[model samples]
Each structure stands twice: as C-alpha cells, then as structure tokens.
Target: MLKCDFQYQHADFSLNVELEMQQSLLGIVGVSGSGKSTLLKNIVGLLKPDQGYIQFNQHILVDTRQNIHLPMHRRKITLIFQQALLFPHLNVKQNLCYAEKWLAPSERKFQFDDIVDLLDLNGLIQRKARQLSGGEAQRVSIGRALLSSPNLLLLDEPLTGLDVQLKQQILPFFKRMKDELNVPMIYVTHHLEELEYLEADTLQLNHGQLQHN
Candidate 1:
C-alpha cells in the first residue's frame, strides 16, 4: 500500500531507496548509521527527499517533480520512537486520549478501549507517565499510536534500550496488532531476533539501499 522511489542527501551521507510495501508487517534490519531512519523520515514527510516520489495507496504523499509534498500531520502516518515520549504530566489514559483527537468518531478505525485492551493497559490508565516501568511505558506508547488510527505505523528501533525480558514481553503485542488488529507496520531495528520473533518479512538496509535478507 506504500511505494517510494526517492533520493535524499545530507552532508556526506546520502539515502537512495526504492521500496514498495503491501499490507503486511515488514522489518528493516540495519546497523547504526545505515540510513534506515533517514528513509523512514523521508517517507513520513519529516524530511523531504531531494528527488522522486512517494505514494501511499492512491494518495501521492510526495512528488518533487510536481512540487507536491504533504506535511507530516496530514499523512495519517504515526511514528513511535526508541523512547516512550509520552507527556510527562498526563496520565496513561490522558496520553492515549490525546491521540483520539486526531480522528473524529466516525473516521476512527480502532476504539480507545480496544487499543487499551489490546495493549493490556487497563490497570495502568490511572498511573502517571513517569510512574510506569519501561515495558509498561512502551505499551502505553503503542496504545497511543494505535488510538491515532494511523494508516501505516513506523517504528524506529522502539525496543532499543529495553532488556531482553522487556522486549519479549512487548513482542507479542506487536504480533497481535498484526494478526488480530491488522496494523500495517514498518519496523526498523538492528536486532534481527525481534524480527524473527514476529516472523516478519525481512529486508536489509545497507548503505541506503534495500535488499532481501
């Protein structure tokens, strides 16, 4: 449902990739500084590509030739970073509720309660963001992203700093989101074990290019 053929340059580093994704969970494996994040930023419109285009389903998200570049907010793409960037003052429920404002009632694909349940976050609702464990915070972040009803989810090494136990705890949730909730995701990480656990279709991102793993 997504297609990209773009070239982006940053100082001495350049990212040139051509990728097409169907409605499935895709994993991108790369070492540090391999332009994996750069490719994602370009797709999500955080950084405009110097040339080529990006199409999501039938919508043209970027077309440098036509001078068409949709802003990040308008793309309906949600990005989850390595850290759980939840609002410090907001409780878990409140942080999740903030994402609900992105789509109106009729336009929403997933309900807030369903997301909370899917993430197994019912008990954590009343807790402050800073009061949760690493795994709990990540679950809340995932729930918040799902509540936003994004057409495509981009995860940028979301489980980076978590321990093996914590990563194992959260991996099943991602599988459920793919198997049950049917969320299309592009998960980028250096850990191949995570991809193996999810049984995701794998690709290797090396020197700004994509190849079958």
Candidate 2:
C-alpha cells in the first residue's frame, strides 16, 4: 500500500493530503490550482511538505519530525507529465535507455523490446523526440517511465492534448499495462471522462482537501 499524510505550503495556498492507495490505478480529479499537482509532487518527493510523513509499504519516504526525506531518485517512483519532456537530441530508444542508468544491478529493468511491441513504438524508436507526433511522443514518454521499473507511477494530465483518435489509440496501452504489470499508478486529470476508460478508483481533491465523489 502507498500512504501519505503531508502538508506543503506554497505562496498562494497550503496543501494538506492524507491518502492510502493500493495495487490498482488510482485516478485524481480536480481543477487547475486545486492542489492535485501539489499532492502528487509530495507523494513523488518532488515537493517536501512542511510537516507529516510519507510511506510506501515498509519504506519511510518522508518524516519531517524525524528529518527523514528520501531523495526523488531513491523513492522508486516515476512521474510522467503532460509534456513528453524527452531529451530533444536523443532518439526514442536512447530515451528509454536513459532510465536504465538509474537502476541498481539487483533491480529489474523493463525489457525494451516488450515496451516497443506494447506501445507500437518500433519504427519510431530511431526517431528523435522532436520528430514524433504528440501522441507518439507521449507513448515514448510512457515507455521510458515504465522501463525505469518504478514501484509507483504518477501521471500528470497524461491525456491532455490528444484528440479522440489519439486517446483511443493510447488508452489500450494503459489498460494493458495495468492488466499485465503489477505496477501501481496514480493518474491525475481534470476531466472525469479521461479516467473512465482506465476504470481507476476516483479520488477528488479541492483546495487541498480530499473527497470521495
């Protein structure tokens, strides 16, 4: 299980979150500035909370009282934003390989060939990030994150710019990932429809408070 109880203070607002998640796709829904991103950041160790703790199973991610804050890379968590953010100069395959460098020798790395076939990224593997379409780039982005072998996956508005056709093309990959892999994911989006296809347990957030709607 993934558990977090943290409060982060920003200039505009403070975010207080207390949540527990399990081995399934958990979807977060909120408007912009509703603290959805802030909550995710705290979970993934991107933003440190002023107080409280974060724990994934037996691992203590953050405990402000104990001053135990794990760095982002050591958390075994991967976050993929709306933007692909792949290295502009690197080809698709290279981008996927980049994640391997962070893995420990004992840790498992996702097989590149399997990712290619699952995401239908064969021909585009040689193409640079700048050369791919938005949907294609997002596919590559998901491929790269998956290959990193994270214990938890955090997706931030992953379906943002895609049209209906692209959404149709990409959603099955997410379904396949959930069915075929045990990796737990937190998918965040403002539109409820985007997450319906994933069939994730919905968590609603508004102004830093969590609600089940």
Q: Tell me, by lDDT, which candidate is best.
A: 1
Q: After superposition, how far is residue 155 of candidate 2 from its true place, in Å?
A: 0.2
Provide the lDDT at 29 for model 1: 98
Q: Which stretches of candidate 1 lie over 4 Å from their true place?
A: none
In model 1, the Cα lDDT at residue 107 comes to 74
Q: What TM-score does each of the candidates earn?
A: 0.98, 0.95
Cα misplacement distance, residue 174 of candidate 2 (Å) = 1.0
Writing each residue's lDDT as its tens digit, candidate 1 over 128-187 gives 999999999999999998888889999999998899899889999999988997668999
Cα lDDT, model 2, residue 95: 93
Error of 2 at 20 (Å): 0.9
Per-candidate clashes come to 0, 0
Report the lDDT tens digits of candidate 2 across residue range 87-135: 9899999998898787775786578799889899998988989999999
Pairs in steric clash, model 2: none
